[model samples]
Target: MKSYHLIKKKKNYNHKFLNTTFCDKDKIRQAFPFTALIGQTNMKLALILNVIDPRIGGVMSMGDRGTGKSTVVRSLVDLLPEIQVVNEDPFNSHPNNFDLMSQNVKELKKKGDKIYTNFIKTPMVDLPLGATEDRVCGTIDIEKALLDGTKAFEPGLLAKANRGILYVDEVNLLDDHLVDILLDSAAGGWNTVEREGVSIVHPARFILIGSGNPEEGELRPQLLDRFGMHVRIKTIKDPISRVKIVERRSQFDRFASNFLIEYQYLQDFLKNRIINARGSLKEIKIDYQYKVNIAELCSNLNIDGLRGDIVTNRAVKAFVALNSRKSVIDKDIFTVISLSLIHRLKKNPLESIDSNQNIIKTFKSIFGYS
Candidate 1:
């Protein structure tokens, strides 16, 4: 018989290896997988849709402490796909979205050869409550300006979070100045600076994510309206499910190394699903009636301004996207309204007498959902 090594057919060597650097290893290490999180279904759903379509502003989770509010927010990292960005760009600018590039950078791009793209893991920059205004909005390098007669705009958290997620823990406690800066940047999707005689503006578009306990303090109305979606998370009361959570956590901790190895495939599988959902969002359609219903609900609820309508529409679109649907439907609109509008209601002292019942009654009458 011929030798096996010589007789075996040779495999083709032309296939290219996929650049896996987009896979955010650091994010994964920092956050637990969404699938691994137990309970908080509504919170998880809102977050899922937001990640699938960042235009839904971003999700705000408010609830009791240790109720997995923060846990769910952090877990989002594992569900996102990697992104392509310009090499050496501090803002993580997409090589294709040149419209958002700065004037100087745009000119540079015209003169330079074709801009090269590099794969980077999607980012989720956390904005701590204690951060200062200067740190958040960025400061100029005075020394460099004086010595070299050149102005260098140091990027802030918003710049770093471009085309990615900006998570704020205990957002209600953030300083007023910082809140104003965040709100301004979030509203226009760009940050304009006119300080130290150095004028600069750059794209600061990012998904604004926040989680906090209501007991600490209430978020400002102006800032609250900026969020696209709001979710309330409560402690799991079921004995069995609670037990399972403990057991699962214990099992993972006991076999940390082996557990991660075994679950890597599962994590990647979820990431792929999210990527597919994002692609599906663009193809999904919405009917005029759905828009009318959204408007009616907001109007009846006495929601201020047109932001609620916009957020409601975006939330429904995101929900449909997550379902991989071709068009928006009544059910999608209703579900989104419940999650996005409940926390946003202007509290009435009279309504507070039986808030839950009154809210449910109104919802049933309007949307006819049980």
Candidate 2:
């Protein structure tokens, strides 16, 4: 009966489609499929665009608890396309991109050595609340270096997260110092650990995704501004959508394998779409006028720095690429401008306007959104 229903439900669905089991039976319970996540479109777009172009910086998702922030972020483990990296490399070094390769791997490549490469799921690292700096930034074995004259360094979350995603839940509750460290590594694209004259530097580039409940606490504007995009997730209030979300979760919990099998097609389509977007992101062009409009939008909003303008441009390009379009359109700018600039606007406690509304109004006025 199950097989009959699976076959008859979607005419285009073929059992042989997607040979690889997207959700392994054993690990099926580990994460929910990304395609199955419903609502929270802004959060999903921000996350997807970051994957499409890591140079868009990272995403800051602030919303109510139980809004699927953590679940959606973790589900990215399955949604993301595989990345090719040097096999067994601690930093997840890219096979040919020297900028993303570790020094050791780069040296081996320079020596004309055969570098073994493997395709692995893009990593999604969870930064625990109680994690220490050393654990997050890696520690160097100074004693070993002093006695054996060899530098022995241990890689940390930042190293493992290279070329992947680093997710911090309840980010507002995390220590400010640690947040600073994360922002620094995220902005610089490299992490350096030094101990007693011993030092090691490695690529730490990753999509830094941080989520928190606004009711818990607000992140400092300085730290928040560093994020490339910010999205606010609200609990689903519509009766039908709420019921659908609940039913889907219950079905996923009860029939993990069948549920996964059912969603595999959508997952495959989204993963491939993301892969294509990444490939064509560089080809998606933005006109000079659009660039000026982006800058003008930021300027009119009184955004603190150029980061808003830069991120807005990058995000629009990613959105265009995600849709397989070669040129950004007015709708693309209208879609991405708020996510890229809303959090950067200076707070006006005395002002009556809502931040989101204010940004949208300014965007429509400047971009002629009508």
Candidate 3:
């Protein structure tokens, strides 16, 4: 079934992005299949897990340049299931996500005329480095105020990205204050704008995705902990994998249309699988033993709070669903431990050990060598 909802607006909707002035039309409209990406096993896994369960929290992918970090992030757009939205809603607010609806939409509904609706690609709005505060959080509609003396709100990037991905490339360079606003919205699932005597609130729930070079700078610890999973990518060293990546890009450049046609089936298959997985997610089983295992693993790591434990459990479920499995097992926990707890681990610069290795050691100690 489609999730549908109502929205109130002054202007008749135009689906062409009123924002996203920075996006390339071709890049935003079409992308290489997620299945086609080469290497970066952990990075791919981290991305897919977030898609499966946004409640797992958002993903942070940090690495050196030329590791396909941005490519991997953009290609995810191709595989997302279509979302039902009120016709022309700048926010892409869901038809049934009434909690996020405007007060006007609520009042208009009392008349009992069914609100019109349509399905569209779930957006992935890029938070450009130079975007002004008004562009990010919206501002009072100056035209409305001047022409008609009407106080109205103009939806901005946060509104447009509702129920979608807010991707920040080179996120390390983003202003700390802007990052703080995103952190608040990602945590609480709403954005409230109070400016020019205009107060408008809308749901800002989205899967936050950020990629940056670690050498440039690290995210402040307060912000880093907000991300549920952190993944690092390395340049592909295997000659065969490198060759495959180059060949794929060459083929794409040489015959863009043909390349897309060749992968269309694979893309559709993945899309349908995700749709089905989402439908059946609540039915997918997680064992009581698995719950205990997640808790014990986090405990052994001395990770603060239950976010680590909760995110791990959600990631394991997503992994099972993505693999078409109905239930989770011990091996699932082992696969997710590093992704869940790597960033949460306290760094001991003097200890001279990899946090990832420590994650594995903990897994082995808890579950025994297999």
Choose the strongest candidate by lDDT.
2
Q: How high is the lDDT of residue 279 in model 1?
A: 88
lDDT of 1 by residue, 14-57 (tens): 12212342233332355556778788888888888888877777
Ten residues in sequence with the least summed lDDT for candidate 2: 14-23
Model 3 quality (TM-score): 0.88
What is candidate 2's lDDT per residue for 198-222, written digit by digit as tens?
A: 8899999999999999999999999
Say which candidate scores most in TM-score.
Answer: 2
Would you list the clashing residue pairs of candidate 1?
A: none
Ranking by lDDT: 2, 3, 1
Q: Please, what is the TM-score per model?
A: 0.87, 0.92, 0.88
lDDT score, residue 273, model 2? 92
